[model samples]
Target: MAEKASIKCPSCGTEVEKPKKTWPLIGRPARDGSRIKLMIGQFECPRCGRKFKVAVKKERIPPEGR
Candidate 1:
């Protein structure tokens, strides 16, 4: 496993599995100087089958537990 942590589905609050391939990325840099991390872990809801994004940086709990 690349790394893992707890991350709930924004739509269903279902604890989703964080895969190693799900590398964290900046959602998109703002015209301003600041940027926000986005929900790199995109998934198709097994129940709804709707594409949705989820933020893992905070809940992903790095291996080092940063």
Candidate 2:
């Protein structure tokens, strides 16, 4: 059984299924287009047959008591 997940895309705001095996995915959209290559698994969007990258933004910790 696959675990249910809810996540939002930083760009395009496209809603997609978050598969359990895709939890550790690492990908980035192609600079020229929407061609995406994932490090965890393979997937493609059904809309335009383009893949969306799993871009992760690290939260910076502000200096405490500065």
Candidate 3:
């Protein structure tokens, strides 16, 4: 199973799920469109309604066949 990723609310230290929205901060998609190379995420803390940003990068493991 793929591991789930999460970030903490910098203000409150509460664990939060993936950001509600994301914008490409840098990099571009591979020629094959397999993934987004990099991005910046905007997250809102459900507990305090605080907003924050985080840098995100996509990575994957090669298949066993490789």
Q: Taking the tens digit of each residue's C-alpha lDDT, what string does model 2 give over 1-66?
A: 954444444345555555233434434544543433333433344444446555332222333332
Q: Best by lDDT, which number? A: 3
Cα lDDT of candidate 2 equals 0.42
Per-residue accuracy of model 1 over 6-29 as CA lDDT, tens digit each: 666567776666533456675444
Provide the TM-score for each candidate, comma-separated: 0.39, 0.27, 0.61
Please provide, for model 3 over 2-64, each residue's C-alpha lDDT reduced to its tens digit, 9 standing for 90 to 100. 766678999999987879999875444455544444567899999998999887655542333
Candidates, ranked, TM-score? 3, 1, 2
For all candidates, what are the clash counts? 0, 0, 0
Against the unseen true structure, what C-alpha lDDT does each candidate score? 0.55, 0.42, 0.73
Runs off by more than 4 Å, candidate 2: 1-3, 6-11, 18-39, 52-66
